[model samples]
Target: MQKKSALGIMVLAILFVSVNLRPAISSIGPLLDTIRADLSLSSSEVSLLTSVPVFCMGLFAPLAVVFNKKLGLKNSIAILVAAIGLFTLLRGILPTYPVLLISAFFIGLSIAIISPLLSAMIKRNFPTRTASLIGVYSFGMGLGATLAAGLTGVFYSVAGWPIALASWGLLAIAAILLWLRVKEPVAEVSELPLEGAASVSPWKNRRAWYMLLFFGFQSALFFSVITWLAPIAIEKGMSILVAGAVLTVMSTVQIACNLSIPLLLERWPSRHLWIMVSLGFGAAGVLLLMFADMIFIWPAAICIGITLGGLFPLALLMPLDENKTADDVNSWSSMIQSGGYIISALTPFTIGLFYDRFQNHMISLSLFLGFIAILTVFAFLLNKKPESAGE
Candidate 1:
């Protein structure tokens, strides 16, 4: 009973930390115009508020393993979470472009370092329940994005942009307090091979490379839709209000899927089937958006949202499922994420290039379809053998 209670507390703490991951970045979107007007910033300059952090997520993800090796799991998480909270609070307190830029870098650094380590922590503590716990983790992140995007504008009306951005820090403070109540994870040495898991380099692992490529394309698909779905709707002749509704549908379904997919994996555990289904939804949605009339928009949104929600928790589960020890999961996840996010961050820019040359939303959507097809091939290769499949 005591163990159960401790697990409950730990899960809540994980949820809190998962939520803090996004508000420092997502909050900027809702108030972008207001922020730009106040600061008199150009579009390219203002765009860095988001892109800089994404680049940092890719560039700094490997630091997660470094922190784990040097500071140990609990210390690393605590320090990183503190960095997230402190930099976020500084954004509100300082409230200038240069300070905001500086704060964004630190906030991004904190998130990058903590993400993979947290995955290993979940695997270590809830070895049996890793799937459901991951569901909770991704659910918390999706909830964070929703809350930040939905409420930040309202908060700005009540306070100024500074206070609005800073209000998110209160959530971080609550996260820190709750996180203190949970105990750190212990390494499971007996389960690992004779060779220490820590010494294994993911750079040489073919499976880890597969995981990296899979993660990159899936993230690219999700972010491309997030960045382009509404614009696509508008380009296809929907009014601005109607276009926003399509994006809302996608987001709503995504959050629901993020909460549910890992739980489904807990019961079904057929990774290949879920992976194919999720990718199929993504491909179908893109096709519908590209070729079908606006009447098909609702179905496309629902399908894409389902794909967004399902793929992430599954991608997260892959490393945990493959590795025996927390250290191995950390190495594998960090390696996967490090290269994965760089692939993801470049996607929007590449798509913009396609748009520049072709000048049609259809051209971009067609490119999305081609990527999805390639992703499907990788999916089959990754899960073709029964051994590789999380059966």
Candidate 2:
């Protein structure tokens, strides 16, 4: 009975923290134009709103190990969540470009570190249930993005961009509260290594590089769609509200798949096959967006949603699948995410730059096709050269 109660709380605590991770980035999409026009920023410059955080998420991911060794998983997450909340709140309170940029960096860093810590947390607590818990974690993030994408427009209409942007921080407060309820097992805490816990960097392995590239391209596709999908909808003669609704559809569809794909993977566990399926959906999504526009907006969103839903959990599983020990999962995941995020971080800003240069959403959308193709190649490569056990 005690065990059941604690597990329930742990699940809720995971949901809360996972939910807070993406809003700082996703919320900006619905309000991008308003922000750009109000602040006199260019498309590329505004793209930094998403890019900077992603950049930090990649560059600072190794800090996860450093944080775990010093503060312990429990305290590290608490501090990071608090920082996420504080920075998110500051965005609304300060409401300046410089402040927004600065706040974005810290928010991204905090999120970056929390990721591996949470993975470590899940590994320690639910060794046998990692896949299901990862689904929960992914679903929570999808839920956060869906809410932000769907409702930030409403929030902006009601209280303006400052409040809409800043209000997301409140999620952190709730996360912190529930997170307190999740007590780490004493044994797990006592076994935590302090000095020289790091393993050979994932960078040293070739298959690890393949995993990084695969993660990077898939993530690039995901973040690009998140940042630009709504604006492209609006460009096709939809209202901001309708555009927001379109993004809502994309994210909502992703949530359903985020939950379902793991179940599907249970039956068919081929990473290459699943990823190829996802990239096919992504290609169709981009083509539809470019050629069909709002006429097939729902279809495009759904296709992209399928692609995102399938790819993320698969990416999360890669290191976990390759590694046996929790430490290996932690080390490989940090390297994969660190390099993957850095590479993926460039897509949004690059798309924005292309839009500015070509003044055409077609060109920006074409880039998606390019990313999908590149991703498909790496997907094939990763499968062709499977990482050896304990590699």
Candidate 3:
């Protein structure tokens, strides 16, 4: 009974952290024009601004293991939550582009630390429930994105974008307080020194590298659509309200998909089939949107959401599948997210740059989606056989 209660508390804490993951970054997609106009920024500049947190997610995640070792999970999470709150609050108060840029970097860093640690913590503590717990946790992330999409307009109307952006900071404070109440899990201490871990060389593992490539390309697709899909709708003659609704609809579909995926994975146990399904759904959605008219939009959105809902959690599960120790999971997470997010960071700008050059979405967007589909297949094939050290 005591263990169960502790597990419940930990799960709630995980959800709180997950909920804040996307709101700080995803909210900007809808408010891009307002932010750009207020700051007198250009399209290219706005795209860069949006990608900042993602860059941080990748670059800082690898450091989480070291931080966790030094500080312990409880203290590290508290510090990160507090830091996230502080920087997010500052994100709203920034008076200039440079300050905003720096704040964006810190926000990304804070999120980066939290991301891998949460997964490793779960793996260590709830070995049996890793998939189920992470499923709920990932759903919280989707919920955050959904709320960001739905409420950005309402918040912007009530208090302006700055206040709207600042509101997310409050979630961190709440999470920090609640997180303090939970008992931290006792995972075996890391034996690899910091320098040794850093020098371990990720290139030695061919399967891990392949997993990184696959995760990166899929992220490229997810981030690109997330950042631009609503704008694309508005550009194509939809109202902001309609665009918001479309995003809401997509997220609703995603939530359903997220809930269902864990059950499927538990039954199937073969990740290749699931990965292929994810890639296939995404490809179909993009193709449908590319060719079909307004009538096809919602269906395309649902397809995209379902594909992504499955893939995102699946990617996180991969590291755990490969690693026996918490340290190994953290290391793989950093490598995969770093490689993945490096590619993801380029996607929005790449799409924007291509769109700017061609002044059209037809070929550019198709090429981007198509590339992600192809990469997903390649990674799926590599992971088809059980290759984890733990396995």
The C-alpha TM-scores of every prediction are 0.77, 0.92, 0.86
Model 2's TM-score against the true structure: 0.92
lDDT of 3 by residue, 38-78 (tens): 99976667777668888888777767778877898678878
Score each candidate by Cα lDDT.
0.76, 0.85, 0.75
Error of 3 at 25 (Å): 1.0
What pairs collide in candidate 3?
A: none
- Local error of candidate 2 at residue 156 (angstroms): 1.2
User: Per-residue lDDT tens digits of candidate 1, residues 80-117?
Assistant: 88888888788788999998888878888888877767
User: How large is the C-alpha RMSD of every model relative to the true structure?
Assistant: 4.7, 2.5, 3.5
Worst 10 residues of 1 by lDDT: 187-196
Winning candidate number (TM-score): 2
Residue pairs in candidate 1 whose N, alpha carbon or C atoms collide under 3 angstroms: none
Clashes of each: 0, 0, 0
Of the two candidates 1 and 2, the one with more favorable TM-score, higher being better, is 2
Model 1, residue 267: what's the lDDT?
92
